[model samples]
Target chain A: MRATLMYGPGDVRVETVADPKLHEPTDAIVRVVQACVCGSDLHPYHSMDATTDGVPMGHEFIGVIEETGTEVSSLANGTLVIGTFSFQDNTCVFCRDGFQTACVNGGFFGSHDVPGAQAEYVRVPFAEGSLVPVPDVSELSDLIPSLLTLSDVYLTGYHGAHMGRVEKGTTVTVIGDGAVGLSAVLASRELGAEQIILMGRHTDRTDLGKEFGATDIVAERGDEGVAKVMDLTDGEGSHVVIEAVGHMPAYEQAYGVIRPGGIISRVGVPQYEKAPVGFGSIFGKNAAVTGGPAPVRAYIDDAIPLVLEGKINPGRVFDQSVALDQVADAYTKMDSREALKVLVKP
Target chain B: MRATLMYGPGDVRVETVADPKLHEPTDAIVRVVQACVCGSDLHPYHSMDATTDGVPMGHEFIGVIEETGTEVSSLANGTLVIGTFSFQDNTCVFCRDGFQTACVNGGFFGSHDVPGAQAEYVRVPFAEGSLVPVPDVSELSDLIPSLLTLSDVYLTGYHGAHMGRVEKGTTVTVIGDGAVGLSAVLASRELGAEQIILMGRHTDRTDLGKEFGATDIVAERGDEGVAKVMDLTDGEGSHVVIEAVGHMPAYEQAYGVIRPGGIISRVGVPQYEKAPVGFGSIFGKNAAVTGGPAPVRAYIDDAIPLVLEGKINPGRVFDQSVALDQVADAYTKMDSREALKVLVKP
Candidate 1:
């Protein structure tokens, strides 16, 4: 099987790898139909050390179940499915509470023991619990790109909106311009936010954000960005602030732009080891701060219908597509800002 | 007018201060019937320096309106009322949004210009907005002590529950056993929580907590305390964790006990300037951290009715009482933990 592997920093290659097998009765063999380079993939791509072993990559994918183990009862071969970034047993107390990302027996796809999604085939554990089948993939064929996003990005954006308590008449300020941030803009609008403000400096992304229901844009960063959003909100700040960037400064921007009694939902994977959440930071305004890895499986059931019905088009975030052999070019293009997101065909 | 004044660290005196008079058209002069020394008072009570001027102390009080300025329309002379820790116009954007504590024109009770509640008389700014009048005080005379608590502690507790999203059937863990923590136990019950856990080491306070509706009490500290709570919730953690202690360890305990997707509402005045809010700390669990100075005024209307009807007895937290000349003794008893709280009569 041909798969994308990361050798070291600034080194990526498409190489033939051993095929995955069903080692457990609960597992299923999935033939990858479509996969994409994710933002988090850049973490190891930019910093893989000298002695690091080549690692297979890609966590987001849509596929067809090529084979199913004896214990996998719900799914069958040829079932069209969307596997979330992480696999879950879906019966743990946490998963039952809709926090599948924290499931007791969950595992991520590109782990050392698991084959990555940017390949011809991958083995899925807890197959029935880990997969959400598209009811009629052929009927919804044209919505594949949008449906693929539910595997990670769009679901994450929806999580941000949901966490921030975005709803009808809510004034929302999204503090990022990346694909997730743009997806959050769409999610906020879908949640019926009265005013959607996108804070980013990129003309290309901001233009897309406007099309996605961003009523206003603030290109400034840090304090300046906070000031611009506050000015637009008549100095009271937005009712719901969605923090799509997970760095300290992004968190600071969110704290500064949230109105008293408002919520700041952060979805970006945090980069810092510690952040101040003391009286002066969050307690003074009676604000709320929450966010984490999206439980995409929990959300897929509700979000897929929206995509299938054409109520939202978060798939537009993918601006370029490349063959599996061109994964390196896709990375280079995304890292250099030449493309919003790159879709890969296996 | 006789008032409690802080001249230096460990130096409290009963001094004759100028009687309060209406200063603004929206002001009202009130004769305090009851006042209490707050936990926050200890901050300055133990740290006043040689260069520091004498500052009047209390902020919690129930009183009778003595006079009203020309523009004060709603409150009449002799009206029995509860004055919140801070005074606000109640018309600012923040106040309109139910965050009266951050109102544009609001000010605390113990400021240089405003007389503290420990004084015989206080000139309350924005009288119509700052005071919640008790309907037919004579009929509810026996409930005065509990009504007095609405000014701060009880309201603060309610704020914690509300911020943590306490609702029917919620499992709540209160991280302190102080008056506020016990009040949170009571507030959690009022908010319809099914199982309430109080985490503290003090037998006396925990007894009070159980009386206030604590279903369980965990006396451990640090990781042990977290483990105890996790054990209580089937190793998943509580649905709403209310942090009533204002220090770093208390915050850490809150983070440890909150279930994934749970809320941590902290109302304790923070002792530190910065606390960690990183990925390892909060993001991975998808938990929420929120709270601040309680919007006591916003909750007064609903809470007061319950207190007035003798349905809740938060004033039991006031375990000691002192006359005007014995203000120093009241401080000593409360500071030494001999009393959960102290009521002062001026």
Candidate 2:
């Protein structure tokens, strides 16, 4: 089996690796049908995240169950499924409360001793709780990207909007023009937000954002960007602010554009060690800060149907696709902003 | 009229000042029946807050309306009312949304030209919107202290619990031993929390917290404090953490004790300029940070009845009393920790 491995910063290699097998009674083996290079993957690619030698690299995938362990009765071989980034036991206290990312018996894919999804075949722990079965479709060529996204990005976008409490007739400002940000725009529209503003300078991303139901676009940055958003909101800030970029400036921008009593929901993997969440910045406005790793498993069930029904086209973010051997170029394309998302056909 | 003035850091003086008079069509002049030193007042006294020469000090007061401007219709001469720290016109967008602290065309008491409530007679702007009237009772001697708390501390406490989303059966951990922290314990009980823990060091304050419905008290500081709280909460942490102290350490304590998806509601006037709200600290836990300056005016109506009925005794925090001439001594006592809260009779 071939898998993507990162030896160090700016180092990515698609090399032959040992195939995955059942490691636990609750585990299942899945043959990867589709996966992608996530923005978070850039954290290690750019050397921003600590990485050891030869770590398996992906956490998003949709696949077919090839085998199952003795204890896994809920799923069978040959079932089509989507798996969240972290494998969670659904019965854990945190999982029951919709915080599957913090599940007691679960941890992230590609982490220590866990096989990643960016391979021909991968072992999925806690299969019954971590994998969501999708309807069997005769042709999956078009649905693969969208289904793959439900494993991470799409659900993360939904989580941002949900945490931001975007409601009907409310104004929403989504910072960052990445795939997740565009997905947030789509989710905000799905949640009935009356005005959706996408803050991005890129024409390519903003074009997709507009198609995702963004009512406006602010090309400015920093204080200028905040002023533009405030101007659009009639001098009061937006009712809900989605922070999909995890830098200090991005957080500051989100805080700056949130109206009094509004919420700032962030789904971006934070790049900073500490965010200045002070009373002078947030308390006087009575604002709130929420969002983290999305409970992808919690939203996958509801989100799959939307994609299945063709109500949303989150797959549009996949502007580039490549074969397993070409995965290295895919990372470069994404890193250089030449691609919105890179679809990996294993 | 006599008022407390901050000539500089650590310099407080009780001096005769010009009596207040109606200045706006919506203004009213109130003869302060009672005023108290707020925990926030200590900010300027301890040199943590910027102090200017002769700045009148105080924002919490219960007073009798002595005069009303031509446009003041809801409140009139002789009405007893509790004034929030800031005066707000309830018609503003923020105020209508229940965030009176961020009201437009409104500002805090003791700010610039705005006279502080800790004087014989103070001019109140936006009288009808800023003041909550108490039922007139002939013998009001015993009810004065409790009603006075309605202006700030108690309402701030209630705001913390409300923002933290304290529900019927959740566990609540309040971080602070000040008047506001004690008030939060009382408020959490009123909000129907099944288990309440107060984290404080002082025997007197913790005893009062227990009386206010604290089921447990963790007297440890720093990591030990968090460990004690985690041990009490089945090693997961509390469902709701109330940060009644405004400093960074209190905020960190609150962050340390919150469960995944839990909320930290803070109301203490933040003395620090920035707080480190990192993803490592908050996001993975799926926790939230909410609460600000209490929208005291918004909760005053419901809270007043609680105080009037003796359902809560926030005034018990007032362990000492002083005449108007001894207002300087009041600040000293509170600053030196000799008094939990001080009551001033003008």
lDDT (10s digit) by residue, model 2, range B92-115: 899999999899888899865897
The 10 consecutive residues of candidate 1 chain B with the worst lDDT sum are: B44-53
**Residue A329 CA error for candidate 2 (Å)?**
1.2
* C-alpha lDDT of residue B61 in model 1: 88
Q: For each model in turn, which proportion of the native inter-chain contacts is also found?
A: 0.88, 0.85
Model 2 CA deviation exceeding 4 Å by range:
A48-52, A138-141, B48-52
Residue pairs with clashing backbones, model 1: none
- In model 2, which residue pairs have backbone atoms overlapping below 3 Å? none
Summarize candidate 1's per-residue lDDT along B12-42 as a digit string, tens digits: 8888878887788999998988888888888
lDDT of 2 at A209: 95
Against the true structure, whose DockQ is highest? Answer: 2
